[model samples]
Structures are given as structure tokens and as C-alpha cells.
Target: MNVGLGLPVDDPAALLTWAKRADAGPFSTLGLLDRLVYDNPEPLVTLAALAGATSRIRLQTEVLIAPVHRTALLAKQTATLDRLSGGRFTLGIGVGGRADDFLATGLDVHTRGRRLDEQMSQLRRVWAGDAYGEGAGPIGPAPSRPGGPEVLFGGFAPAAIRRVARWGDGFLGAALPPRFMDRLFRDVEASWKEAGRPGRPRLVAQTNVVLGPDAVVEDARRNLARYYAFTGNAAHFVDGLLTTPGRIREAVTGFTEIGADEVMLYCWAGDPGQIDRLAAALHG
Candidate 1:
């Protein structure tokens, strides 16, 4: 299976370092997370910088909260990135659950799913050279590939899984066990078939990773605790991270066994050295 790495948004200075290392390493994609009320690098902006820095690695938004931004603007931004990256950009989008994120955007959290559905349709129109409105012209500079970047819908609910067939080119699953991921992947495939979609939806799964010395591993755990505190079960996530080479290999193998097209390893520790370690663990 194709393997990807998630950028450490906690360290902006280390982003380019991670980008260059991942581009030179065994990674198929360099991805980052998105959060409105948190201290995280904005995916598009950071990935744009990364696109200029790396010529090989594909850059992706592991899952950008779609309803948080305007559709036309989002389309223009993604198209520009795709052009700059030479068609190596993948748009992983979802309707986020965090209420604080919606509050910051002045949007009703409960309505985000509907808003994202509308945005998905709007994004296609905007990218297909359609006018923005009755008088507004089409957004400038289309994406490198037709239909803009391939969109991967991320979420676990039934509606979210259904989005894979309705609006997305694939399903971007969150960090979860093999059984959960397998069930969701099956659901995504079932939805695609039920919708009369041809071929299977691209299936990508994510998991937290941190492999290094005691200090580095501990740091990752601490950061994860705070990062997932909103979940009210931070310990479950913090303890579930793949902290060893054996765990990493097992996770990748499990995902591959489940028929995932790609597995994105999320780096909680903002250290470029993790790239080599990852390569050694997965490729050796």
C-alpha cells in the first residue's frame, strides 16, 4: 500500500524540514491537519509552501473542514495549489465536529454537514469554469487536472460514508482500529455501488505515530493528550498511538490487509529525523 506522512503543525519552523525530508524519503504524500480554534498550520497555506519546497512528494489536507471556508475561494486556492504542485494535491475534506471550530467561523455547528454538502456541489461548478453568480465570472486559473483535485470525504457517520459516492472521489478515514476501518471501507464501497458509481472509491486511512528516544516519545504523548482533550477520552488516543517500529509495521500491514489504497502516518512529534526512522521501519 502507498504510505504517507502527516506534517507536525505544532512546529511551523520544522514544516519545510519535514517536507524536504518526506519528499526525499519513502513517503507518497505529505499531509497536515486543520482546526479553526487550535494552534495549527492552515493546511492550504502550509501545503502551498511545501509544494514549492518539494518537487516529488504529493501534498494533501488530511481532512480540511469544508464548511469553515467559502466554496469559490476554496476552489481557487486548491486549484492554485494543484497547479503549483504539478497536479500532486489531494483535497481531503469533511464536516468537522468540534463546536468551537464552528463558533469561530460564526457558523451553526449543527448545520455544517448541510453546508458542506452544498459547498461540494459549488466547488465543482466553480472549478468547471462556471460563473460565480449571475454577473460574476468564473474563478481564474483552473486546476492542473480537470474537475480540480480529487476530493476525499472524511467522517464516520452514515451520511459521511454516503458522501464518498455522492460528492467525493474517495473516503478519508480517521485513526481507528482495523475492524472500524474495514467496516467503514466496506460501507464506502457499498455506498458507491448503491449510487451506481463506477469502480471503488479511493480508501485512505490515518493513524498517529511517534518513534524515537524516550524524550521524543514522551513529548508526543503529552502533545496528543492536549490535542485530543476535547474528545473527553484523550487517554484512549494518546495510548493508542503506534509508538514502536513493530506497531507501525503492524498498523500498515493491517491497513493493507483491509484493502486501503493508502495509509497516512501522523507524526505527532515535530522532528524531521522521524522520516528516516519511518523509512527504516516501513521499508527495511
Candidate 2:
């Protein structure tokens, strides 16, 4: 399995440094998190900057909230980013669970799932050169990849699995436990087969990691608490933080055993040096 690093979206300067190092490091991809109501930078815009900064590392929005954005605009932005990155972008999308984000975006929280379904289909159609209305032709410039970037759906629900089978190219597994991930992976494969997709869907798993001294562990826990505070269980997330090399290794091995194509480690602290620590832990 390949390893990737998630960008620290809260600090713009630190994120840029991390992006550059990730490009030069042993990591396979650079991942981003999205939240409109948060301090984090917008994933697509950040990715465009990273595309200009780095050449080799693949970029992914660990899961962009699809229900909040206009379908065609999102499609155009993604296609443009994919082209700019030379086809090194993957669209990991989901109907986000944050009600505050929905309210802020003037979107109905209850209709998110249905809206996501419609949006995913529309994104594909727009990417496939389908004409809009009367005057607008297909959205351009065309995606670097034929049908746009590889679409990966996040969330582990029956509906999410069905959506992946129908419109996505892969599954993006977020910070779930190992046993849960095992079942989720099985369900994804079953759903893909049931949907008559030709091959197994790609699976990517995400987890949080903090390395270096004890201060770094505290920083990670504090940052995680702030990021997940909206969930009302920030302590739950902080409690699961991986602070040691052994824990990180164990997490990586477990994900790989459960058929993850890639394991993305999201750094909780806003420090660029975290990438080097992670690389040393995994590769050295």
C-alpha cells in the first residue's frame, strides 16, 4: 500500500511548506480537508496553488462536501485543477454531516443526500462534454483524464456505497476503526459487484498522526480538538491520536491488511517538519 500526507489547512504558510516537502518527500499523495465554516483554506484553491508549487505528488480533497457547492461550478473547478495538476487530482466527495455548514451555505441539511446524488451525476455529465442549456457548450478545458479526475466517495453508509458503485471510482474511508473498516471494505466490494462495475473500487483510508516530542503530541491533540469540536466529541478524536512510531506503523499495517490502496495520515499540528517525521517513521 502507498502512503500519503494530509495538508494542515488552518495555517496557509505552514500548509504551503508542507505541500512543497510532500512533493519532495517519499509520500505518494497530498490530501486536503474541506469545511466552509472553518478556518481551513478552500481545498480547490489550495490545490491550485499546490499544483503550481509541486509537480509529482497527487492532490486529493480527502472529501469535499458536494451538497454545498453548485454542481457545474464544482465540476469546472475540478476539471481545471486536474488539468493544471497534469491529471494528478482525485475528487473525494461526500454530503458532509455538518448542519452548520449546510445552514451557512443556504442548503437544506435534510436534502443533502438526494442533492449529492443529483450533483454527482451532473458533475460527470458536465465533464463528459455534455452541453448545458442552449448557449453554453461543454465545460472546458477538458480534464487531464478522460472522464475527469478519479472520483472517490467518502462515508460508510449503504447509500454512500451505492453512490460509489453508481458514480464514483473509489471509496475514501475516514478515521474509522479497523474492524469497522474491514466490514466497510467488504460492503464496498459487494456494492460494486451488485452495481455491475467491472473491477474492484479503489479504497483509501485516512487517520491522524503526530510525531516528535511530547509537545508535538499535545499540539496534535489540541488541534484535533479544535477541528472536531463541531462533532461534540473532540475528546473522542483526541483520545485516538497516534503519538508514537509504533502506533503509526500499526495503523498503517492494519489499513493495508484491510485492503486500503492508500493510507493518508492527516497531521494534526500545523508544522511542516511533521512530514519529515512521518516519512522517517514510515520509510526509514
Candidate 3:
């Protein structure tokens, strides 16, 4: 299975250093997480810098919250970044649930799904045309890719799956049960077939992965804590689910079996040394 690495870093120089060493050629793609108040740089700005620093590694936004920003402006920014990266950008978008973010933007989280749907429709229209005017066509500074950056929408619910079918070029799976992953894929495939779409869209799943027997227990616990915290799940359950390197491999293999085209493993390492060890194991 194709594997990508997503490292959430707080420092731009550290991010740059990681990208440069990444020229070692192990990861298929590298992604940045999008969260404004998390003491992290903005995803597109970081990726714009990455596009300049690296030549071949694919750059991704593991997801940008669509409801918080204007759709046309977001598409333009993404297209410009994609142009700079020579079409190596994949725009992963989702409706984020952070209450602070919503409060900051003064957007209603209750209407996020409907707002995203409208925004996506408007984005496609604006990307495909010039202005919403008569004399204009083809937006200036178009993306290096013919139809703009590939859109990867993420969510696990049935409604979410349908939204992806309607607008996204692929589905990005969050932390979901194995059986539910199967159901999600099935729904997507059925949606494509029903729509008479020619080929299946890409499917990428993200999960926390541990790579060593010598890995620090505290780091693993912290990783589980953050993972569970995001899902509102209790961190205690993850210890039994992914306690060993063998268990990690088994879970990945199971995801592959369920039609995951690529698996992007969040190294789950909070310390510096853990990064190298995790990458080495992923490369191996």
C-alpha cells in the first residue's frame, strides 16, 4: 500500500528541516494539519513554503475547514499554491467542529454541513469559469492541474459519505471502526456507480502509527490521548487496540484489505528522535 507521512509541527524552520531531510526519499506524500489556534502555522502558508523547498514530494492539507472561510477565496488561494507546487497539491477539506474556531469566525456550527455544500458548489463553478460575468472565462493563475487541485473530502457518517460523492474527488477516512470503513467504501462505490461516474475516486485513510518496540510509553499514551480527545473518545481504549508494532501493521493491512488506496500514518511521535525511528519503520 502507498503510505504518506503527516507531521504536525509548530515551527516553520523545523518543518523546513523535516522537508529537506525528507529528500531522503521515503514518504510518498507529506501533509500539514490545519488548525489555527494550535500554535501551528497556517496550512497553505506552510505548504507554499514546502512547495518552494521540495521538488517531488506531494503536499497536502490533511484538511482545511471550509465553513469558516469564503469558498471562492479559499479556492483561489489553493489554486495559487497548487500552481506554485506544479500541481502537487491535494485540497483535503472538512467541516471542522472546534467551538473556538466557530466563535472566532462567528459562524454557526449547526449550519456547517449545508454551508459547506453551497460553498463547494460555488467553488467548482468559480474554478471552472472566469468571473460570474459574461466577458470573462478561465480564472487567472489557474492551478497547474487542469481542473484545479484534487478535492479530498473527509467524514465517516452516511450523510458525510453522500456529501463526498456529490463534491469530492476522494474520501479521507477519519478514525472509524473497521466494519464502518467497509460500509463507507461500499456507499461511495454505490454512489459513483449510480452517478455513472467512469472510475472510482481515490480513498485515503489517516491513523496514528507506532514503529518501534523501544518507543517511549509516555509518547504513545500522549498520542492516544490526543487522538481520543479529537474524537471525544476515552484514551484508555487505544492501549489495547494498538499496543505493539505488530498490532499497528495488522491494522494497516486490514485497512488495505478494505480498499484503502493510501494510508497516511501520523507518526504519533511527540519527541524528535521518535520521528526518525517512525519514518525508518514506515520506509522498511
Model 2 — TM-score against the truth?
Answer: 0.97
Candidate 1 off by > 4 Å: none
Better of 1 and 2 by TM-score: 1
Candidate 1 least-lDDT 10 residues: 6-15
**Model 1 clash pairs?**
none
Where model 2 places Cα greater than 4 Å from the true spot, the runs are none
lDDT of 1 at 150: 87
Q: Report how far residue 43 has shifted in candidate 2, in Å.
A: 0.7
Q: Candidate 2 clashing pairs?
A: none
TM-scores for the candidates: 0.98, 0.97, 0.87
| Colliding pairs, model 3 | none
lDDT of 2 by residue, 48-71 (tens): 999899999999998899899988
lDDT of each: 0.90, 0.88, 0.73
Please give the distance, in angstroms, between residue 222's alpha carbon in candidate 1 and its true position after superposition. Answer: 1.2
Better of 2 and 3 by lDDT: 2
> Which candidate tops lDDT?
1
164 Cα displacement, candidate 1 (Å):
0.8
lDDT of 1 by residue, 1-284 (tens): 79999877778878998888888877999988899899998889999999999999899997899999988889899999999999999999999879999998899999998999999888888888788778888996899989889899999899998888998899989879777799999999999999999988999999999989988898889889988999999999997889889989999999999989999999888777889999999975
